[model samples]
Target: MAAPVYQAPPMPTDAEIARDVRREKRGRIGGRGALYLAATAFALFAALPFAWMLLTVFKQNSDLYDPNLNPFLYNDPPTLQNIGYLFAQTEYATFIRNTLLVAVLVVVITLLAAVPAAYSLTRLAGRWGESLGIAIFLVYLVPPTLLFIPLSRVVADLGLRNSVWSLVVVYPSFTIPFCTWLLMGFFKSIPWDIEEQAMIDGYSRIGAIWRTVLPISIPGLLTVVVFSFALTMHEFVYALAFVTSSAQKTVSIGVTTELIRGDVYFWQSLMAAAALVAIPIALLYNAFLDRFIAGFTMGAVKG
Candidate 1:
């Protein structure tokens, strides 16, 4: 036979139980409502433009010309004709190739220039070295418009006129200064002891720089690569000033010169192509974004 039966606590009265349930429900509902509001607002702010582009890229010339269809709505059955025209009618492939060539090569040039300058500035740690680096960056602030005339002369003198590779050379003039300055700040943040110890060992100065200092500054180096490539990609004024030949035109000038027919803008496809362009840069940033922020933040504090 069972020795004893354990008694359970009685359930609360309905009024008390109902009040507790209502409190939890209210909290849950309030939280959900706030989340919904935030999401809706963000969609309006960030997503609306993309939504509009998606709608337009699919819209027919008839649909686009008509004032009736809503820009915000994508109910129009999608067509890929605008994109088709963009690829088929234009030298879009060539433009992309030209742009990529410059963007990739310029990163190489910027690194070579900025890294040495940065190392020198950091190691010297004197007023002269810092001032010299700052002065170099200040040169970049001079308006491209102002420099364009003189640059034209220089471009002609170098015999790089009307060539995309002209940009591969000229862009460094602008890119190097800023990237060098940025890296200078980052380089300064690393303790000298790291490099000093490497040298104190059997490692030569160059060997120590390669094995120790540069390796540890990977984040800063990547930052320079990203900035250098980005500046090269988006550069318009210099691209326009330097490149006059249609065959040599980068995506920036190519789109405007080839796509825009009078004031009647190809708004949809233009924006679509532009939206595509930013994808790689965004991916680069997202991939190494944490390190970039860390490098900058650390550099800023050290400065």
Candidate 2:
């Protein structure tokens, strides 16, 4: 028999390959466009309330109450009267000062307590540390309402009642538990080999943590700071329970207690206060957002 003629497999034509490439490029563009649309919609949904609040602060009472005018647009010229009134009429400035003081103190206390506790739990506790971390988080899950009654007596016994110092004392109770849990996870995400290497290089365990772990954990620390500060600023029940005087009231309590009277709302001033309080937090969150996300997500995943 004659040797069979050699045969070659067929290859795709250039036009066919080009057509497939175009189809893939179009699918990718379509997928990306859908994602962009979805993100835009979610951003607008989250931002519209803040936008309305901002608009309300700038709006005059006439424009605010006018049903015929567009609610989203200013029909009348804006004025600074509400901002002025908030400063002049109420103890708003004092409230701001008091809140700031409490927040700063709480942040300091939380970071100091949480960092060491988290480090010990994550790095030193051996195998029980993971379970203990979860247990600590569960303590945070205990509602403040449940603990405030018992805590109130302690505050009273400590002679901290009616004082801003009471807040500095009480705020840490709630803040430290969650912060410690958060940082335990964060610390776990750090490699143990790095610390071991530092120790091998003559650094003490504590020194190793200070030099190696902390430098890498700035994001986690900032997340804790921001969270604690925001909590201190907004905590109403404890602030209300411990403080009665306008001078000691935090921003949340001050705005609610002073701004509205007998169903009449000072719409503009209330909105202005909300805007002012929210703006700083918004700025801080935006600044640390990427790091915050990274810290929390990595910590959770690793732990």
TM per candidate comes to 0.82, 0.91
- Report the number of the highest-TM-score candidate: 2
What is the model-wide C-alpha lDDT for candidate 1? 0.83
lDDT for each residue of candidate 2 in 39-120, tens digit (9 for 90 to 100): 9999999999899888888889888988999998778988888999999999899999999999999999999999999999
lDDT measured at residue 196 in model 1 versus the true structure, 0 to 100:
85
| lDDT score at residue 291, model 1, on the 0-100 scale | 91
- Tens-place lDDT per residue, model 1, 1-303, is 977888888989999899999999999999999999999999799877766666677777776776787755554666787777778887777888899999989999888888998888868758788789879879989988898889889998999999998889888999898888888887787788988899999799899899988888898888888878888778899899899787898988887878898887887677656666766777888899999897777656763
Candidate 2 Cα outliers beyond 4 Å, as residue runs:
1-16
User: How displaced is residue 132 in candidate 2, in Å?
Assistant: 1.4
| Residue 236 alpha-carbon offset, candidate 1, angstroms | 0.7
The alpha-carbon lDDT assigned to residue 127 of candidate 2 equals: 95
